[model samples]
Target: MTPAQRRRAAEQAARRLARTSLFRRARHLALYLSHGSELDTGPLLRCCHAAGKAVYVPRVLDGQRLRFERLVEDMPMQRNRYGIREPALRGARRGAARMDLVLLPLSAFDTQGHRLGAGGGYYDRAFAARRSGGPRLVGYAYALQQAAALPAEPWDVRLDAVVTEKSLHVFRN
Candidate 1:
């Protein structure tokens, strides 16, 4: 889709997210910086900032796990081995368990909220800690990325919901 179209779609999805009770109650949100043509999260980040929410972004570690750091205003970041920008860890780290909401990036998804990631296990490893329930995991993707079906493994953590440009798909637990 065109840049204009993508922006408009992202805005629509962000609006839907804003209307959710979860977002309203969430004080800490985990978000990722959009890489390439992925649905731009710029709008969502702004909304979270305006709502007085503290946002955290994951920093990939050597152990194939993620260490989330609080995203401060104008936070300086450094790129990881994979070229993904991560917030520089200047102090003690915070994990995903502390977040109230997690907006995850997905390469593709199905109606069941099965997400296809970048083939890395960082998210899966970190998400394991959330199985007992902590933050609400939501896959952020464009409507075009949805597949009719996708294979899911025992280790592949399914999302609680997925927000697309057109609609929000909430999976049954």
Candidate 2:
């Protein structure tokens, strides 16, 4: 999709997300910064800020794990090994389990909540120990990214829901 198209779709998806009870109840949210043709997260970030929600973005650590740091205005930022920009490790960070909601980026997804990331296992490893009532894992992507089905591994972390420009698909209670 073109830049303008992607922006418009992202805005629509963000509006859908904002209307969800999950988004309304969340106090601390972990969101990814938009990169490449992935769905833009600018609209969601603005919505979160407007609603007085604390927003965090992931920072890659040791090229393996993800550390979520609060996203503050004018905070320092550096690109990870994959060229994804992340908040610099300066202030207190929150673990995945501590967040109320986590919006993950994906390359593809299915109704079963399986997500295909950028071939990196950072998110999976970070949430590997997630238990019941833990942070809700949500995938943020475009509707076109949905596939009929995708293979899953035993260690794969399933998403609780996936929000696309078209709609929101919930897979778990």
Q: Each model's TM-score, in the order given? A: 0.94, 0.96
lDDT of 2 by residue, 1-173 (tens): 88788989999999999999999999999999988878999999999999999999998878787889899877888887788888766666888999999999999999799999989898999899999989999999999999999999999999999999999999963
Q: For residues 1-173, could you state the per-residue lDDT of candidate 1 as single tens digits?
A: 88889999889988889889878999989899888877888899889998998888888778588888888778777887877787765644677787889999989999887899989877889988575568899998888999999999999888999988788889985
lDDT of each: 0.85, 0.92
Which residue pairs of candidate 2 clash? none
Clashing pairs in 1: none
In model 1, which runs have C-alpha deviations exceeding 4 angstroms? 89-92
Per-residue error for 135 in candidate 2, Å, reads 0.3
lDDT of 1 at 5: 96
Per-candidate clashes come to: 0, 0
